[model samples]
Target: MKAAHFYLLLHVFSTASVLVNAFDPITTTVVVSVGAALGRTIYDYFHERCDPKWISFNVTGLEVDLENKLFGQHIASRIILKAVNGFMSNVNPKKPLVLSLHGWTGTGKNFVSQLIAENIYKEGMDSSFVHVFTSELHFPHPSQLDTYKSQLQQWIKGNVSNCERSMFIFDEMDKMHPGLIDSIKPYLDYYDKLDGVSYRKAIFIFLSNAGGESIIQTALDFWKAGREREEIELRDLETLLSLSVFNNKKSGLWHTSLIDKNLVDFFVPFLPLEYRHVVQCALAEMEARGLRPDQSVADQVARDCVYFPKSERVFSVKGCKTIESKLDYYT
Candidate 1:
């Protein structure tokens, strides 16, 4: 035990020394040191292997709970769940699993992303291997495009090199400047070798409201035509969603080679939530708060939500975005 502790200290110190010498900024060096330490801690906990009990936990249970938790959009939930299972099943993939989630303001894009991270990562959203970058938070200034580009690339490369199974989530992709997302093209490239970084094992997720209008329109059309919501399959809206995302000038990947190269594995569309979905969202919030389920409160919260299309009554335009606050206010 003493010898093992000594070896661990020696290894950590040696790695920290290398990082300190390589990075000039004390902050960057410190971050690298901390990351190294965390990596060692995680390694010691799992003994250099992923926790099987955690990884192999019943995904079906996750799917069922997500279905109950996230109101409506059953198709989207199933598709995403299946994709996650498939991607994680691969021990080492040749190409990274890239998922672009497109929908409206509160259509569960961010919520579902968090769900995925939480289930797969032991630390949930706080997992060191999971990195989230919001447009306004990380690359707020358009003028710093060049700096952001280099920094983004280096960040991905460094993290992936450290842990190939790293997951990268980019939120508010619509708010990101055009041409900036291309900086990540090399990592998402199919060549298998980019700047000596093997990005194949990494997972990339982009959340955006770019194709919200189109998705809502499709759903509205279906509803008006008296078509069952269950019939709306991925085939019904995949092309239009992808085109809208690529054509939208405000999108980060607008006119970028990432779309042209067809690197994105799946374009999951989160449709607008209905009144019933809002009620479910309310119930979910209530359950999360450890409060007993109350149909009256759920109905009240759902009624308080604003729906879209003033002329024609549709579902909650913002999905469950504001339902929590409303639930709190009501209950």
Candidate 2:
């Protein structure tokens, strides 16, 4: 007999035997009938369907290292949490909010954008503190900043309406010129405006390549010291951001070398230490995805990544201060 027929026959025999001896006929009849129906349903449900991979909080057992790296504790998760928490904290029971994220290249800044939005927005598909009104933001070529700027302005003005604490993140923002920065000006609009781009809730984020100049310097040094032309263009973003000097007292903004701008150049500097989180997060993400970065080959690249430590900060161990940690990292 087939599996279903066998199950039905066995259940019928068991029920007949139970009824023959059942002390309480009313309860036994009801119970045996329910068991026969449930078994058939369970078999049909589990027989041969593909298991769906639904992502949820309990899915990944790898607990996030909140304080995992040097720039400070919980740097990456904080940027995500800040935007999400801000939205969740103020979401009215009756309204909707929006999130906008932009990325330049290499940093995988787009990944974190998804994480923040997914975690908070999961509360409900249609009603949550945040929404992915536009998930990916792309800048036009650096030469045509105005064209892209006009497009961005229209996108922001159109998507965000009637909400508070919206977030706009410009990932790998270091690539574009300062001119694009003006697209987002402070207004009563929901977007978070920084430099000139906008997102909701007014918390504008610009994720740099890290140290533009330093990365360039190291890349040049690697080329001259010397590798062939094949390795000049690096495949990593944090390494590029780390090479650029975050301060301007000595060498002016790194982009100035690429673009002939005469502004005070606070566009890059005004960003807080959290920007480095973008770099660290970028690194952690690569490891998670099993994208093998050749460390020896990337030594120059990694060197450029951490070259932009602020004046007030240095490598230190618990209860001790030292540059040895920095040396250890490079070595």
Candidate 3:
């Protein structure tokens, strides 16, 4: 009887131990599940806050009309529109669309970029996907070059990784630190994958006055040689403009691999506007202001702008930048 009782006690003890192990701590299990739930919720909240929703855009007839309406950049305008249209058509492209717009002040470099943003995005200038970085505003100090470099890289990677179709416009690129500009080279690379980011569907536009002189001189040469302004092709100045932008030490992209690799698909030159284009601008502004555009007013506004080659006939030097402001004087 004692032996049987001992065996029974042993079995009971073993069963109790197994039961204890199986249900060790219900509270611990509940706490772990709740912790995991909270962590996921926090992660989701930040992810939604940080990453914007990007809508697929289509090239519409209205955009084409706007391109035509842009004055004095016949070849450049066509090239920009064609590249954007083609890029937008492809849902997943193998490469990004990189365009460098080089020209004189007020020749519509910024204006063209804005027009593109307005047409391509539903939010127009306020689109979250359209990021415009100005040199003086975004990266002003030379001492902050390294900081800007890291910030720029993160900004590009973050935005592009979230939405590959994002558009980045860097205005006054001629004034940005060369090092800061060079920091963006990796994003423009021909790689299919880069650091968990695919930048093939992104669009980058660099606007600057770096190659303005070369472009203006080329146009002047064509003018003096009796070549029609309509006959001017971007190929006429592409090689020279690229060389000028790259070789110039003051250029934002000085010695950039992007320039060396021919990675920039287009160097769209905004030629200096002639007197006629300025008149078109004045009329457009007047119409926009609810004033009936007058031919004499437009002519006077164009005439007031200072021009180069003072010995020869004058052209609109500022290309309608101040045309709207000057219209008040005429009216």
TM-score of each: 0.83, 0.35, 0.81
Residue 292 CA displacement from its true place in model 1, Å: 0.5
lDDT of 3 by residue, 99-121 (tens): 99999888888888877777666
Q: What lDDT does the true structure give each of the candidates?
A: 0.82, 0.39, 0.81
Clashes of each: 0, 20, 0
Worst 10 residues of 1 by lDDT: 48-57
Q: Relative to the unseen true structure, what is the C-alpha lDDT of residue 56 in candidate 3, on a scale of 0 to 100?
A: 42
* Regions of model 2 farther than 4 Å from truth: 1-73, 76-83, 91-111, 123-137, 140-143, 161-167, 187-204, 211-331
Best by TM-score: 1
Candidate 2 TM-score, true structure as reference: 0.35
Give a tens-digit lDDT track for model 2, residues 1-331: 3798777866765675566456487777776776667667656544422122111232121124223422322223444444345444552412222222222233234445444434433332232233332213465355666787687666555444433334455554444455455554433233245345333343344445445345334434544565632343323323333234323222222333222222111122111222233334435434555755334423332333432234422211111111224334543
Report lDDT (Cα) of residue 274, candidate 1: 85
* lDDT tens readout by residue for model 1, 1-331: 3778768867776676666667769777686868778678746764533344333334775687687777677777888888888887888777898999998888888888778877776666777778999999999999999999999999998888877778899999999999888988878877677767788878899999998888888998899899977789998898998898899998886887888999998899888888888888888888899999899999998888788787654778677889877876888
